[model samples]
Target: MRRVVIIGAGLTGLSAAYHLRQLRVEADVLERETRPGGACRTTSRNGFHFDLTGHLLHLARPESQKLLREIGIRNALRSHRRRAGIALAGCVTPYPIQINTYRLPREIRRDCLLGFIEAHLGKADSDTQPRNFLEWVLSRFGDGFARHFFIPYNRKLYCTDPAELTTEWVGRYVPRPDLADVVDGSLGLYRKRVGYNATFLYPREGGIQLLADAIAATFPPVRLSCAVRSLHLGAKEAVLESGEVVPWDALVMTAPLSHLAAMTADLPAAGRAAAARLRAVAVVNLNLGVRGPAPRREHWLYVPEERFPFYRVGIPSNHGAVAPPGCHTLSVEVSLPAGAATASGLRERCLEGLMELGLLRDAADVVTVDEVHLDPAYVIFDAARPEAVSTLRDAYRAAGVALAGRWAEWKYSTMEDALWDGATVARRLAG
Candidate 1:
């Protein structure tokens, strides 16, 4: 029996433990937090329940479906009604922005439609590679869509210009509509919802955290409040935070690659330098409880206006009975570059914007507000990201350490992708 140690106890760590147990492998999980589910945890305050951020499960692969079923929460899953919108130009437009371009003013809509037509006619050959996110959006959806929605939304979420990011990260996350489809949708000739996230599933009782908690429960011997201050990977021993040392044949680490690099004092200078180049974004979640029935809609609302500090908002009561009756709870998500500003300032800006957007009628309606700041929530994928990630990966492999999860892999992945990565890594270790 091989003894394995898993760190973090987030979705990725917990999933790895669950799969390892299923395969009858001996394992122990160490989590710095008292509870499991790093970003997936949900908390209740004054009769309101809030997830760290609104997470919806929308797996497009059969393998993901199998993993969900294996976790025993398959029956509890329910798809939300397809309802989402974007706040643009003081009006709410249906999500996918392209499908609802017709809702714009006549002049603006005409400009967008004409641009789409012209770009479609002069389409570049498929063989040409898009140089940046902006180019990718224009190449796929045309200049109209890029200028109207993609550019602004990407800026809000990424906190960087789209031209600075790479396009290989855009596939499957962004939908590309044919010229006929765009024209028809804009002209009301025809319409369709296209994207992996169009429909999503959530737990009926607890929020998405239920899935992570369930995975954690499967591993009974998990160590809580155990932080990994440093790791000394010797020829046959591993040292942990409490001055305790444990001998091991192999190690699998799920900590952020940047943090891992900082811990390895013996790592080559070149490896350390490459790790410094990897950048991450911070996310702040402002969970608010309002007095009202659930919002008229279930899907999240994307805010694209410069006036709003939040990029998106998710209503929990709309999901089901998770939120208290007659009280609406929402998660307002704001993405910022690391160390952009203080949390208080960001919270104030978000509240003002919410009031202006009518999401909050007034300050009086806000029953409670809980702010959560998550660092390294997103990895900025630029042209250099591939090289940076590859360099770190090779260095870790050489040290007999394996990396997993979004931070470890340094890729923008959905919740399903994280779970899949965890399970895959566990299986390989067990075999």
Candidate 2:
């Protein structure tokens, strides 16, 4: 029997454990936090339940949906009526940008429509490699749409200019609407919603934590509150915190690559240098308990203006039954570059933004505020990112340590992607 230790206990860690149990592999999970879910935990305060962020389960592939069903939580899944819009120049536009062109000012709308037509007329004969996120957005949606929506939204969400980021991160994360859909949308004739995230699933009772907890429960050997400080990677052994050394033929690490580098202090200087160059965006989630139901029609609202500190706002009450009746909850998500700002400052800015946007109306509408900071929430895919990530990954592989999850893989991934990565790690270990 092979003994495996999984770190972090997030959706990825729990999924890995669950899959390992299915294979009858011996495994133990070590989580630094007292709870299992890392960023997906749900907490209740003063009769209001709040997730770290409003997590809506939207699977990119059928295999992911199948896995959800296999976990038996599928029966508990309820799909939300997709209600989302982008707040631009004090007006709410239908989300996915293309479907709601009527919300924009007449001139702006005409320009956008014309740009779309021109882009189609000048369509390339062959696929041109996008130099950056800006080029990618323009190439896909034209300059008008890119400047009006994609650029501002992405800048707020990633805390960096789109031009500084790579285009590889755009795959599946952003949807490209066809010319017919764009025309129909412009003519107010499009009936179908635009993107894959139009409708998403959530658990009936516990929110997304249900999925993580269920997976963790399947593997009983998980150790909680065990923070891994360092790793002593040898030819046939690995050691964790509390001086407990576990001998293993192989090791798998799902922790952030930066943390992994710190763990393997004995690695070559070049490897450590490459790891240091890898940058990540930290996220501050301000969960606010509000009076009554949500004021908007959508599950989420995107802020593309500089007036708002948060790039996106999610109302759990709009999507799931987790929030208390007569009381709604909003998760204000602000992405900050690492060391860019403090959580308190960011929270205050978000509140101010909410006031300016008229979402909060008055200070009295706020019942409670719970703040959570998720470090390394986004991996910045810059020109140097691929090289840095590859070097670190190769170094870890050479040292016999497995890497998985968003930060581990250094990809801008959805929750489904993280779960898939975890399951893949488990299969490799099981085999």
- C-alpha TM-scores of all predictions: 0.94, 0.94
When summed lDDT is taken over every stretch of 10 residues in candidate 2, the lowest stretch is: 232-241
**Of the candidates shown, which would achieve the greatest lDDT relative to the real structure?**
2
Candidate 1 runs further than 4 Å off? 124-128, 235-238
- TM-score for candidate 1: 0.94
In model 2, how large is the Cα lDDT of residue 299?
84
Residue lDDT tens for model 1, 1-431: 55687877888888888888888886778888878888788887887778888888888888777777776888888877567887777777677766677666676577677777776666754567778888877766677667767888889888889899887777787767777777776766655677888788888876777888767766685788887777665553555678776555556677788888887757777778888898878898888888876554746888876667888987777874665667788789999887566456777788788778777777777788988888878889887788888888888777777799988788888888878788888898888
Among residues 3 or more apart in sequence or in different chains, the pairs in candidate 1 whose N, CA or C atoms overlap within 3 Å are none
Candidate lDDT (C-alpha), each: 0.77, 0.79
